[model samples]
Target: MADSASRAVFLLQLTDCHLMPEPGQLFRDIDADSQLRLVVDDVLASGLPVDHLLLTGDLVHHGNAEAYRRLLDILAPLPGKRHWIPGNHDEIGAMRAASAMPCGREEVDLGHWRLLLLDSTSYPDGRGSGSLSETELVWLEQRLAQSTERPVLIALHHNPVATDSDWQDEIMLGNAADFTDLVAAAPQVKAVICGHLHQSQARSIGQARFWCSPSTSVQFKPAQADFLLESGGPDASPGYRWYRLYPDGRVESGMRRLAQVAPDPELG
Candidate 1:
């Protein structure tokens, strides 16, 4: 590893691992467990020096115990310091069985970045919302005030802005405008990262950059008018986003897709 002061902070962003016990179903007939394993294998084989692996959420499907167990089995061998925030399909209690990941709040200092992982899965209808409770907002405000020099990266399970698709727009962060106001008020906020959209996108609002990473399982076609699952194709391969954060306040980000070999060639 290079000197922490000079080396760019490298983070791997993974999301939406909707694992199911039975295989060959929806979402391209892609087995979530196998796809996640393939991503980890490729990341390890590439030998990229990653500072942390950040999973934004939907770590499991149906929030079942067995699914969480399978998620653990796949992630146990993957290298690097890991952190996670849950999504709509995840259950806080079930995910706790595998790791000590934050359920609603987390803060970490990585080089020049102060990362705040928020739990934005606060909706009743199995969709996502971004309502930071009064307590959480106060805590975040205090943290922002204290660390004015370091760039802040906020991670959540929902996109803070609409992707302009009707189906997704309806299910996205409900209190996005309020969240945006808070982010705009805090100049230390350099970027906002999230999952749930299952696609790669980068947008700018105020002075901050917002990025949504591709999923480790399936991906939704961006800007499609209706809700639809993607088919098995070159674009649906499991992948992640790599972020390079510079001390001088510049960010260079890119996507990396795993080369997945069908578990059973005959089935395909």
Candidate 2:
């Protein structure tokens, strides 16, 4: 890792890989493993400086231990310290068991800033909806108070802001207002990055920006009233997000998308 005191720390945020336990398994008709590999290949080809790899969530669709292990294997070639949070599809215990890296610790010190990983899957209302628990809220408040000087960047599985897609909006962070209230009060908190909507998006609350990245699997069509899977074209592609966080509280983020993936015709 680069000295955060000297310069900016580059963080790569890859979300929603959705890998299955089986080696050649496909999720939603997409070759989940191959798609992730493509993204990995792109990252290596880009030759980006990566200080930490922050996987926001949904590393595996099956919640199997092997899948989590596989995730590490696939991402092994990438450079940086790795961190991750669980998504709705992940089983916490299994993930912790399977992970070679630290699993339950929520905050990581990147010198100038502290990255906070919240548990949005604490309260799953089934059908993919998630909310932060009261206990988690208290923990967040304490962490914020403990390090008021360090700029904060929060990562979680669910979006804290609505995506405007009716199906996705209903399943967004359930206690968003409460979450927003706390984040709004903290001026040092710079951004919130998430993964569930399966498409790249950015929104805001107060001084904080919310960045939602596309899945490494398949993407959901944005700005829709009904649930719709992106079938073809650029929108259906597998992609990831990256951010360059500087010591002076600057966060630069962008999306890197692989070639388009056509939806499986057999499912239809």
Candidate 3:
């Protein structure tokens, strides 16, 4: 039998694929199909003990049906469990068609921990806004209530609280306070994982930790002033973030940036 207490759950985080499988490019000089393919290749070749693959969001460039289809094809070869959450650029209809075991909510039991996937997307507006709705909040409260013994990890596409980066702060979740309040009361809530900033960042809110994953496509340079969008400069290597959640309720993570052979002409 599988030793429930001894085993650990490893979640591989990949975000912002921005896949534009067609001939044309998308997202500020990024070739979605090529860059995403490279990241996928790296993930598969890493041979890491990944219990599940989590695509946080922005999997497609335009949230179109065709883009989602292409993404499904690219990710088809990946073994192990997979979970997805929609972002500002995600199409609900397209996601439904692409995922075999599609679900808006995933409550995965990872031995001593529980992973909760939440959808914080307000469609049509590119700026982020998180709404749990009364129904969803109630469900979440109940879920957390079920057991205080298991460490709970919350995953969402938008940053639940302000990150101080002015550019990203504009697109942050509007209902972040409400969400934080909920997590504060729940002792089991360990950390909050998110992707949308297109850059890796970390901040603490209340008793929880909030982390943003770097993109598999183009990256947004860390800002100091107001909102700024980074364009071509030099670094073209693709990157991803790996997070380890310890049984003692501690967390450790790092970024892995790959070296591409040469800059693609399409990007210039």
Candidate 4:
């Protein structure tokens, strides 16, 4: 790697693995175990010196302890410190038990940037929607207040902005207005990252951008009035997001989809 690339903090965001209890189990005809393996293989082959691994959410679909254990084993080879948060599908207790990094440790110091991971599984409405508690909201405000000297990147499992899909939007962050209003006031918050949408999309609030990454398991089709999976197309390939945070508070990010994992035509 070039010195410039090496100097910046490189972070990989993998979301919505949705792994089942067993290796062969499939969600929407996409094998989570094998798809995540492909993602890991892709990262290893790329040879980026990932400074940190930010797993946004949906680490496991079944909320089983064994699946979380399996997730750790699959990702053990990838370099750097790992941090995660709870998704609607995740069992927080199970996830914390399977990993050493406490899910409650929200702030990550990345030299010039602050990475904040928030638990968005509270106050669920049973349709996969989640809301932040009054405590967590206050906590986010406190963190944003203190990070004036460093740029901040906040990660949560729910989308804080609309994906334009009615059904999907219905299940997005329930208090997104509250969330985005918080971001709109914090100029130091460079971006807000999230992943329940299972597709790549960006919306802006104040100086920060809200980015939703593609899922390692399966991707839902974007811009639809109704819910639909992206099946058997270029966009359906398993995907992830990468970011390079520079010391100057400049953040450069892009995404790559693993084309090797072809989408199943019957899934839609």
Q: All candidates' TM-scores?
A: 0.88, 0.93, 0.86, 0.92
Report the Cα lDDT for candidate 3: 0.73
Q: On residues 1-268, what C-alpha lDDT tens digit does candidate 4 reach at each position?
A: 5465337898889999999877898888878898899899998997877989989888898567788999999999999898998899888888877877777438988877899889888899999999888889999999889959889988999998887899999999989888888888888888888989999886676678667789998889998988899878768888888887888777777787887432222111
- Worst lDDT run of 10 residues, candidate 2, spans 259-268
Which pairs of residues collide in model 4? none
| Full candidate order by TM-score, most accurate first | 2, 4, 1, 3
TM-score of 1: 0.88
Q: Judging by lDDT, tell me the better candidate of 3 and 4.
A: 4
TM-score comparison, 1 vs 2, better candidate: 2
Among residues 3 or more apart in sequence or in different chains, the pairs in candidate 1 whose N, CA or C atoms overlap within 3 Å are none
In candidate 4, position 249 carries an lDDT of 78
**Candidate 1 error regions (>4 Å):** 21-28, 127-130, 259-268
Off by over 4 Å in 4: 1-6, 260-268
63 Cα displacement, candidate 3 (Å): 3.4
Where is model 1 poorest over a 10-residue stretch in terms of lDDT?
Answer: 259-268
Question: For residues 2-90, what per-residue lDDT tens digits would candidate 1 score against the true structure?
Answer: 68797788888889988764444344466787788888888888777788888888888765666777777787776668888888877
**lDDT at 199, model 4:** 91
